[model samples]
Target chain A: MDLHLGRITWFQGGRDKVAREEVKSLEVYETGPTLTFSMGPQHPGTGHFRMVITVVGDIVVRCDPDPGFVHRGEEKMCEYKTWITNIPHLERPAILDAAGMTYPYVLAVERLMGVEPPERAKYLRVIMAELQRICSHLYWLGLMGVFAGHATMYMWCFGDREYLVDLTQLIGGQRITHSYFVPGGVRNDAPSKVPRELVKNFRTYYRMMLGKDYPSGEVPEDFRKYVLAVCDFFDTRLDEYYPMLLDSPIFIYRTKGIGVLKREDAISLGVVGPVLRGSGVKSDTRIDEPYDAYPYIKFNVPTMDGCDSYSRMMVGYYEMKESVRIIKQAVEQMPEGPVKLKQHPVTIKVPAGEVFASAEAARGQCSFYIRSDGTDKPYRVKICSPSFRNLIAMPYLIKDVRIADIPIIYWSLNYWPVECDR
Target chain B: MSLSKAEEILKRLIEDLRSRFGDRVLEVNVEPKKIVKILVALECIKDVAQYLKSEWAIDYIKGVTGVDLSKLPNNAQEALEIIYHVGSLSSEALKGITISLSTKVSISNPVMPSLTGIWKGAEMHEREVYEMLGVSFEGHPDLRRLLLPEFWSDGPPLRKNYMVPGREGQSG
Candidate 1:
């Protein structure tokens, strides 16, 4: 019943398993119905996850996501720096989700210290969060397409994502980690033309043939025709990608019912965001726990009942639709105002208390807890990133998925290892 | 549905906690916009968390952080304190209550109970605490060096006393 396994699996100069003596003593639990395989940290499907997923023959029997690979000790560093300096430190996780990351921290600090941002500042925060949401969803779409082997979708989405990145750069002077949203408000007001430019860009890209016109019209008519013929092809592609893998007859045979997270188990594990919603729970920190402008905005939380890799993809796609709704509402109801509040002393001394702030990040619900002692610096700052929480569900989810399907399952979950480890 | 009702529910729940476990609920500090800091005796952390989650339906825990009150040493007994911010997405009442559990552990043994059992979200927070502040959790399932490679020898990166080798004496 007991077996010994050894580290250092290779022989110095040959293609032989040198740790044979170690393997002989291994306590091989009745190999169950399959062989267990570890998937990440270095695997491409995980992107930055650096997670180690164990599978029992194509089915993920367990997923142990070892994050902290990218932990830069951001919170610890925050205690030593001024409040203003900490914004950039916290925004590093998913640089694509900058608004989601920084907004909560700003809100929490603002609340604790007794400062309400100007109305203009509130509107600007709403606008920036919506823009960041679009940018993040686009990035996920690109990754989703790449995982499905639809190289075209991946390329097109990234190419479109550049526009938003440029918009971010124009506003905050940084393409990715725009530490633009400060405690009182944002760093500065956006250029007046930015909103009009946004409408123009969205109108052009979300329509027919206009997107095809980009990049010197190099795209062939056949591609354009292919895109237009399907009418709702852009929308349908989400569902289509999964079944392609599932019913390839060849591919589906490899990836059906893999990494299944039963509905009840998902909730009990406290798994959040898409992983929870993918398992049919309608839990959204944005809707359930509305913060900032979210209470005034309107959007629906999307959930799927399938509770598998397929369901995970569906959740992201449906959520993308909802994000579009949020952005539209934000833009329509956006009242003219200042983006950030009047500048105060750069070095802010927080009250001697603790504040916990959460926001609906692309990964899930990302949170930051700060404990201050009425000083310019915090006594301790802790970050509870969503990727960290969702990663725990991996071991439970990947029980019986195929080795090839590992990438599919991982991407569908939108696992960002840097955020998780951090 | 109103914000005041949420505040009332939290106060009532904390009152019940004070009755069941006296003295442990040190101070129920509420700051309207910012945070609701519930100061508690370290030993009654689980009892308080159980009340918050089960009785008040405070299901989501926003974040877990530690504050070293080395500056307020004259007024406080403990050198370091752990804080929990529990949020509820389901319950309209008790939307935000950051319950603070400050147990005075010796600077040598700055240990606290892990809340990952109730929230499942505190796993990484606890690991980070272990790595950065060198504060050990009594019941953490898997506590290992996170972020920095296991071999890096810069002791507890976040402690107020921790000094970066190259950056020493560069205080702002």
Candidate 2:
């Protein structure tokens, strides 16, 4: 048997026309060069996002992250809703860090309304925001671990996150999408008395989870013990978590040098949160633009110079510890007063002005630019979410990376599709 | 940093901008410390933005918002106002400062120079603005529909005149 490869020539007009000869050449190849495919919009790796990637063999040559699957016309819809009602809607975008996400909008609206929350309210806001930050970071860590094929890490992070979530529920009535932030202050104060047994159990379980101990007699009585226990639990977990991931050869090999974003490129790409800090940029809105009780509380901004996936994961780990420290400090320094202002949520009118308020959220700098035209509702509200800013880095980091490394690189940026789409 | 320090730096930056642009700078409002809103001509936005980035190191764009000014009394010309929230990460002193460079384009013909060339971060933002407000960024590399679908035939949804489906008969 004879097999013909490459081009096949067919004669046109057959045997009838002997004098006229026509050739139709059809070209075929045994091997193709590159394949272009869509990875998301429904894929487990990408949540509510579609990325079209051109891959040559196993290496991704180009990647285009198509977001907006969850776009609910949030900015446009804010104009139709009252300022206070917008909080619940806004928090839905970044559900994991509900307090942190809504804090900036409240701050901006408060600035426009020329109303300042009381000292106690500000401190409460800080505590709630920090707790939400820890919860958000844990969610990211669990998702990251699961994406990287470490099922145990996911279980541990998600299990540990419940303590923080429970604390948030104690402060705010809801678990996620807590519309706790109001224009002037938070919705409610911490319950007059949190069950001491619950706090003690959280402390004990968290300590055992990480195999560490806290100094006795250092923690004060009352609510301080609960806050201190949270701090101690996270502090111990950071040590254990960091060593487990960083020391593991497999983890190191998969993440250490992969998805490297240079410090300059990180800034240019508008990378934020752990992704930015991982690239050695010490820019945190909490420190740079101090709001609420951030100025009063003292906590280190964890940064790593590695500019890689490993460093980004490390930043997330250290940040959880820092968030616990911030919560503890805020709790210790909290003043005694009313948590909410006299202003009603439904009828609050803001003067005609524009205010850009930013809060250092778990993901990054979540900012709200509100323009009030002397109305109860906002004229225009622009939310520059951290996930939206980090979307720019997707194509840049994924270039020339292996298909297997896609999940690690994507999750390392901590890109939340819902938030970005909003 | 204290408000006074931020104000002083902002004052210095405004003075620099005034000297550089002269009459081209329409208005400068620095009432809110750490936020300087500069209203400039459409043509000079690129020059002003390039100066801010190269000289003061305002590297990243926090956001680009397009405000429909048809209903507002301040915008008598019935123009669409584009605001660029420019920020910095390189300089510690300027990190807190958010210089919002705003420019107005006539409602009939809304077109302005794109800042994507100066700051690559503004690429998606410009696209969003382009799709939402129907304002064209002249030199934008990819000024296509960002959030909205290609099949979307209605005018810019964020514009004041663009009525929602259920609220078509209602008056503003």
Which candidate number has the best TM-score? Answer: 2
Encode model 2's per-residue lDDT on A364-407: one tens digit a residue: 99888888788777888899999998998988999999999999
Alpha-carbon error at A396 in model 2, in Å? 0.6
Highest DockQ, which number? 1
Q: For every candidate, how close is chain A to the native chain A in TM-score?
A: 0.78, 0.88
Q: Model 1, A184-206: lDDT tens per residue?
A: 87788655543445444544664
Native A-B contact fraction in model 2? 0.37
Give all TM-scores, in the order shown. 0.80, 0.91
Model 1, range B113-136, lDDT digits (tens) per residue? Answer: 877787666676676666666677
TM-scores computed on chain B for all candidates: 0.85, 0.94
DockQ, model 1, C-alpha based: 0.30
The residue pairs found clashing in candidate 2 are: A41-A49
Global local distance difference test of model 2 = 0.81
